[model samples]
Target: MKREMKEQLRQVFDTPDTRRKEEFLQNFNYPKATYREFLFRQIGYIRKRVWGLSLVLILSAFAVCKIMKDNDATYSMVWVISSLFPLLALLASTEIARSSSFRMSELEMTTRFNLGEVLLMRMGILGLTNAFVFGIVLFSVAFKINYGCLQLGLYLSVPYLISCLGSLILMNKISSREVVYCCAGVSCFVSVFNGILANSKPMIYSDKFVFFWIVLFILLCIAIVNQGSKLIKKTEALQWN
Candidate 1:
């Protein structure tokens, strides 16, 4: 079996066709990984490791929602979700920054696995899990209060995106605790702004507000994605303190 593998490898190296040689080299350089396979591998690891955090966040969100006795709760849900879920998700994001915090960055850099992909996988799991939790709370709230599906989704999305942007911005600049504090402050401020926006002179009820916010969301999304990619690179090159 070893001899056969060696002979095949030799044939590939000795191939006269440049296209075949290049194809062989490309195959050797990059392993095949489909989106589905990655979800099961990297995402699966995150699910098992992070289940405790996810459970706490969901329970807390549900408990908070349950405490609101009033049907017309005066923007309570908005403030809670905007302030809490995004902050929790942002805190979860710092898990990937542990390599820098614990001074394991050098070892992490030496690993054969793709650090960027690992970073992204962790972020995606945290983000999606909180999003689902928040969505359930919002959907339950909508049963008691007045909020359209569009409004619920967009309002929840804005602060989450902002949280992600802030996390990506600070992932390399400070320790994980600092990231949580800074992001919590930001989320609180945005939550207050959301409450004010919803209660006083609400623009969501106005025509084209959805369209405008959608455009704004898309623009912010582009920024988040760009910054997030750069943050991954920064994570890989993080300096030990």
Candidate 2:
């Protein structure tokens, strides 16, 4: 009698009509996440390793400044900061290129945010973080050296922009899986290029050539913007297909 009663209860509760269930759910209102909430939530999704490496670079910058403060190796500080900037920029690019790196572009397109929004948000967050770190480190070195903030900043930013431009170009042109290795190669190349500049053409850091650096910086900024626009369009084009 108990088993029969249990069977009757289950039969009455079990609904085979998914259409009815769907209609029931449609009648109930669900609270949606706000745009600001969604934006902030992406912060948690960013890998912890990026944050760890950023902190290490910041501390290393301080250490370099302290060690070279009393020595005649003040010029070497430029080499150190320039080399570090490429790695920092690469961190931002790697996060930006993550969808392609992991071949998740198709899945991202089906989401509410879409691939472009996701990439832009992550890039904005990481780019700002990198900019802040770069400013603090550059200002710290400025006090120990005789160069103006503008000049010291250029010395640091040029290498970073170069890495970003290179990475963006590679992401636009190369296959997904190979982009990671190419980006790494670009970062290493920019870092070594800084060393070459330091050793072979130390005078390039002089204020006399600051105008040329400014020109190169502007050109790189333009190139990066163009490359970035291309990359965004390429990803967005896939949605229609």
Q: For candidate 1, list the clashing residue pairs, or say none.
A: none
Tell me how candidate 2 scores on lDDT: 0.86
Stretches of candidate 2 off by over 4 Å are 1-31
Best by lDDT: 2
- Indicate the worst ten consecutive residues by lDDT in candidate 2: 232-241
Model 1, range 155-211, lDDT digits (tens) per residue?
A: 667777776676667775775456656665665666666667667755564556878
lDDT of 2 by residue, 106-214 (tens): 8878766767877778878998899889888988898888989998888889999999999999999985777888999999999998888789988898879999999
lDDT of 1 at 58: 68
Output the number of the TM-score-best candidate.
2
lDDT of 1: 0.66
